[model samples]
Target: MHTIQQSASQVVRQVLAGKNLNQALSVLLSPSAGKNGLRITSQQRGALQDMSYGTLRFYGQLVRVLDQLLHKPVQDAQVRCLLLVALYQLLHTKASPHAVVDHAVRAVRKCNAAAGGLTNAVLRNFLRNRDALLTQASISEEGRYAYPQWWIDTVRNQYGVHAGEILLAGNRHPPMTLRVNSRRNSPEDYRAILARHDIESSLIKPGAVLLAEPVPVMKLPGFFEGLVSVQDAGAQYAAHLLDVKDGMRVLDACAAPGGKSTHILELAQVDLLALDKNAGRLELIGENLQRLKLHAKLQCGDASQPDGWWDGKPFQRILADVPCSASGVVRRHPDIKWLRRSEDIKGFAQQQLSILCTLWSMLDDGGMLLYATCSVFSIENQCVINEFLMRNADGRQLPIPAVHLNNGQLFPDDHHDGFFYALLQKNA
Candidate 1:
């Protein structure tokens, strides 16, 4: 337990220092192959992940709560972060207060004995004034929603009357949605398979399944056999929007972890080339393809520099799921709320424009390119699309049904992560 608490606190500290949660946890929790590697059990690792995610989920509010109680800013980053982890348990988890405090006090001593007294005092005071402090923190929208003030304002400015719903949705735990691999099993057949195992799920669309609760993918029947995959509902639209057809050439630019790349293959017999900038991440695409028994030409190359990889062949369809602030998937990755800044949106928009313009040339004269981002920010979505259309005469924005031309925003909900998709077509 001490190891678990220490590991969790360390994960939070790493994230606060600039690394993402996945990168941070992998450093502390991932077991090594050698005998010298840390031997952490599954239960302990699960605890560490839960505490780290929960701490970041309420990070904005918890930090404000600490500021309200602290007489001065904590000089040691680890000490303050440990307090945040303890506070997360006291407020969020069902763990006993005595055990939580005791473990935290011990964990703090393991880090810095000089700050041990401070940790104990702050935690106890919080227990006494928990209600009032939470109330004070809840007064501001940022505090109430546990998002950065700039994030709250930006979403409001873009979403207007729906801003509150969008902000609140990011804080809610996202549902576990999966996409069935049609080649091996239909959504209906997969649903029956789940029922046989006493696991309940509802189909949101033809190929999408929404679980009542999140489960380990390894436990899902036929998961290893590639009968289904873990993908959100909004993401499942990519393959459909791309409209992959038999014998058509498709380019899944910026495709990493290959969810849509695999989905495209499941729908059609397309000659797909999945390109991503990171070589290591391209391996993820390979892994997913191997699992689904799907095939795609995987290459590591920048989408903005097609000259490096493109063989002068035009693709019938392209899926440009560019990197962005990821404001939409905060529920799944709460660290994005802290990691991204308001100004970063401008940089992302510029990159999206570069990739969209570059990839546009690689598409067949009448081909379609679906621009997507797991972001609700307009600058990265419609603004980028609008700017690209203005600069290119051959490219025209194609309207997506039920999606606003200016905001193809899919607000975060129980069924899907907040996402934006703008399908563009090239005209001769």
Candidate 2:
């Protein structure tokens, strides 16, 4: 079996190639992992995943350290990723420095034989002058906090006084919050079940519970029975604010992995039609529905073009949880920080607007459509909301709990992902 560090380097290289963390890890760890993949035990997989996340969490700083250590870039991607993984362990994790260096040297040899001596020298140098090297790297904002300068500036400009808090929160390990399936059990009962299993949790709202520490979904009580779902507290708010009712027709545009779609179904027997652009993602929705013992009409089509998917029927309620830069949930998906570009925000805003306008046309008169994004950007949040309201005379902004009017951004905190929600009602 390949060492954990080698596996982690492979995962990191995949991420650097533009795949998200989940996708990269899945490629490495999945049983059907490709020919170039390494097969390891579950425990090793967990170790690799943790190491990869730690490296990416401080990627900017790590890259800077590499810049200082190496005279030139390592041409081989795997060898470079091995260097990153080793540095992350030596600096961030509690792993023994000697062991990390030794394993990394092995990783380099495995990745490329000629690079072994280079890896050994670089790691030894870092160990000897670690303090000086790290201190030197910390002079820049990116090195100090491990986020891009443009991203840091954007957060500061957009959030003003609270920018630091958002940036700090983005680097944290996100909490694993759960939404109780109210159809089968109350939040209190589920909490009691968790207590029985020695899992400590507290209620964030009536139906949402925040674990004191995250546990695997399989470990949670009645997880397979669908007594609860792993969802962020911020995401759980969307279903609550949607106010789904029995027999009401609802459209869940851009629904994937069906977290909100399932929550809506759990709350009430809605005639929900879940739409997503990708067929592969639609399968996730189906799996979620089957596990929850709930039903929703799943459609694979673009939310931007209703002509391809929507029938002539207007829905009483719609949840337009459109795509955005995903700045709010960076703690959960650190790859977003590196993958997203400055120009992407304006493009996302335009796409969000298109979906909103198109979906609004499919809403019944006086229907409520909850517009949402896991983004703190004003362009994607307030800008799209305001422009859509202006373009559509019938669109009226309705207030909900925790919404700030000054800027529609919801700053991230311990309790929730950075999310923005705008409840709009169509005037009959």
CA lDDT of each prediction against the hidden true structure: 0.88, 0.87
Model 1: colliding residue pairs: none
* Stretches of candidate 1 exceeding 4 Å from the true structure: 32-38, 403-407
Model 1, position 151: C-alpha lDDT score: 92
lDDT digits (tens) for residues 14-87 of candidate 2: 78788888988877766676776777767776788788898888899999998899988999988998899999
TM for every model, in the order presented, reads: 0.95, 0.94
Residue-wise lDDT of candidate 1 within 189-267, one digit each (tens)?
A: 8999999999999988535999998899998999999999999998998888777889999999999999999999999
